[model samples]
Target: MQPSLAELQRALAARILAEEGSDLDDWICVPSEADSAARVAVYVQGYPARIREALRETFPAVAQILGDGSFAAFADRYAKDVPADLQNLNLVGAALPAYLESDRVSGDLPFLPALAELEWAVDRCFHAELLPPFAASACSGWSLDEWARARVGFQPGLALVCAPWPLRELRETYRCERSEIDVDLVDRHDQVLVYRRGFDVVVESIEAAEAEAVASLQCGDALGEVAAKLAGSGAEPAAVAGYFGRWASLGLVVSCEACPLP
Candidate 1:
């Protein structure tokens, strides 16, 4: 019997996938075929190559850590599993950690995944559109009660990443290295926040309390709750206040619903 439209489409899709050298299929077109397979291979393979190139450029430190061979192998598998779906290649490696954790590509490089996460987040922040400036004067209109109940929204580009390695410093230092770097002893775990301050990507090594506080605020927690959580951790209220001011100055605060008068 002849195949239906859906079946033919499916077979054609399979043929396309196979010609692209997909491991899912044995062979696509027979030798009698002209330059069809050859032509298709160019487009198919370019997808993975382009994705790998973008990731390498965005996360040089990760490439350095995994070495060229390992990096390429991992990137190839990542491409096969997660095809390039976004127009922005910067987000290409966002799921790398989850991919690494899977049994297929599991390795001893636990920290490599976290490093990649931080690197991609930083790159994303650098390219994100500028947000409206947070007015310090906005605080003046709110009373103490209203301020306490205010929920804060973070800037679009700010991302708080908890890394098991000194990803923040490692990335900055690697960018400045002359020849290359030998991955030496690395910190077990660290907390880093990547935010775009003005025109530059600013990476700050923040404490756990600060990370949690920022995360809570991002979740739309009321100002009083966020402050209470920070205070519970023995974080100085004055110091936290200063940090908040600096963050606002950097265009990190998207909007604060309510807050005490300045």
Candidate 2:
């Protein structure tokens, strides 16, 4: 009996993954002329090739860490282990670090995955749609009491990364074409604030306290609560207010909802 089209497709997908020339019984037999196995190989090979190319472009620092050959091999295996599901290929490497942790593939460059994560965040932030800027003056109509309980909305592409290395600096200094290198990806710690600043994505270092403040705000905390968190870390109230104001001016806060003024 002839196999159904769906069955053939399933078989082809499986065959593409299997080792070359291994006679797996369930595989759809390739016709002599078409050579289904070879055809499948073409897709399987291209899958990782495309992914590696995209990732190399996105995370040049990661490429530098792994070098050309090792990076390609790693990319190929990672693709086989983690299939792409998103329409936007930009998101393909989002979980790469998580995958690397369990597989122990990143042991040589222990911080590589975190760097990749940071790089991916920057790429995503750059591509996200910008929202209309929010001005602190917009809240001027509200009484002091009303402003206290307002819920703040962040811009579409804000991402915070906590890493054990200075990913922001490393990526900034990384030049894929450079013939010589100097940065060491060793035991250092870094946190990153990635946000869309106008037409560009800006990745900058942030203190732990600042990261916490952003985290609190992102979790829907009231401005007062976020301010309290920041203040406890010795951040002056005036400075904190100014920080949020600047953030607002940059379109970092998309909207603000106020509480009833007392």
Candidate 3:
């Protein structure tokens, strides 16, 4: 009895990813002296190679840290563990940060997972849909009372990543020079804002207090509420005002709507 088309495809995929459990000699015919298995081996080898290339493109910093040989081995294992399910190849490494954090993939380096997270944010920010920045003139008509109740909506391209490592510096260093991978990993915590400015993706390191305020605003809190929270945390009223203005100037805030008064 012949195997179904779905069965054949499953077997082929299993063989390509795991390099096991499929004998193509029965179904495949080769005209040359080379056996049918040899022909299938070409595709089997190419499968992981393609996945590795995609991973390298997405996580270049991780690849640099791991080196070519180690990265290749890591990519092979990752490919086998998490096969690409989406039609788009760029989404292949979406789960890589989590995989790196797993105990299964142990490593001497502790910052690899955080670096992967930062790289993935860059990739995502680059491809995110562009929305026209909110016009500053829109705020001209709001009264002091109305402003208190306003809720600012962040841009779709905005991403806030709080990491235990100096991810922004690490990413920039690797990007500037792959050979210069020496970075001190102790006592460095970074709150990074990843967003697209026009055509470029910008990753900026922010102060912890500012990150807290931004996170509160992003969560749909009213402006007055955020200001109060910051004030309670020892931030002055003037400083809170400046922070909101800076975010607006940076094109981070998209929409500012006054919450309806009850």
lDDT (CA) for every model shown? Answer: 0.71, 0.75, 0.82
Rank order (by TM-score, best first):
3, 2, 1
Clashing pairs in 3: none
* Candidate number with greatest TM-score: 3
Q: What are the TM-scores, per candidate, against the unseen true structure?
A: 0.77, 0.83, 0.90
Instruction: Look at candidate 1 and tell me the lDDT of residue 210.
Output: 79
What's the true lDDT of residue 21 in model 2?
Answer: 46
RMSD of 3: 2.1
Instruction: Give the residue spans of candidate 3 off by over 4 A.
Output: 103-107, 176-179
lDDT of 3 at 241: 67
For candidate 1, write residues 150-173 as lDDT tens digits: 777777788888866776656654
Report model 2's TM-score to 2 decimal places: 0.83
Best by lDDT: 3
Runs in model 1 deviating more than 4 A are 1-41, 86-90, 103-106, 173-188, 259-262
Clashes of each: 1, 0, 0
lDDT of 3 at 167: 86
